[model samples]
Target: MFEPHGPKRLSDIVTGDETWFLFFIIPPKRLNRMWVDGQGDRHVVLRPGFQSRKTMFTVFFNYSGPLVVDILPQDTTMTATYYVQSVLSQVKSVINEQRQKVSTSRTLYLHDIAGPHKARATTQSLWELGIQVLPHPAYSPRLGTM
Candidate 1:
């Protein structure tokens, strides 16, 4: 659908995704080198078995650069209500501010077919913000190739 419009349409397109980030990263064994005086004095490095502390962040970006990077609150599960009130609200403000030079009347959003992204609340919020979502296929043949 977007093949013919070219650069102007591409520039108005914004895509986003959420990812979990580890708060602590273990150093690689190569970087753990120690200058020990004796050959038998090398200490053992233990690796933790438990899951590391992590934070979830939702990031939005366009052709220009990143527009929003919102950290999900600790212990909070992402839901349609939260997505609309928190993330999309910030997106609306940032889009208005960053895309002021270009017209935002037809800003297009592209995201995966996640539950929250396809929720009714999210759709309503996007419409209220004057942003349109590009249709995403639930299944793609090329998915396995990647």
Candidate 2:
């Protein structure tokens, strides 16, 4: 697809990626250990509570570094509508802020081929924002081997 543009400059393209973070942290095992003279006196340690609790963040940037990060609300599932309305719109702000470094009119939007990213509404929203979505291989990282 980039063939039309020929050899491209890093400054001309921007990529967006999303990741999740868990607020809860597990203290180092050594820190949890207590040096007691007797084995029965040793202290016991427990794992973190609510390990599944986490927040998802979408990062948008180019070679210059991160431009924007959107954090999803706790327990919210990312859907197509939510992605376009909340995350996709933020790309505009990133472009506006980095207009001098990036293209003033348009930039390439690279994201995984997830259902939300490929939705018609999302594609349309990107088009309206002067962004062109770069094709990406579809992979479900959540899957497990048979």
TM-score for each model: 0.73, 0.68
Candidate 1 steric clashes = 0
For model 1, the run of ten residues with the poorest summed lDDT: 43-52
Write candidate 2's Cα lDDT for 1-146 as tens digits: 34666755456677787788867766666666666775466655676442646789988888888877999887688889989888867777767766856554457778877788888998888777777666775576755552
- Let me know the TM-score candidate 2 reaches against the reference structure: 0.68
Error in Å for residue 19 of model 1 = 0.8
Candidate 1, superposed: residue stretches over 4 Å from native: 1-8, 25-51, 101-103, 141-146
- What TM-score would candidate 1 get against the native? 0.73
User: Candidates' lDDT values, in order?
Assistant: 0.83, 0.74
User: For residues 6-98, what per-residue lDDT tens digits would candidate 1 score against the true structure?
Assistant: 544677888999999987666667765767885578776575343478899999998888989999999999899998999888888888888
Error of 2 at 116 (Å): 1.2
lDDT, candidate 1, equals 0.83
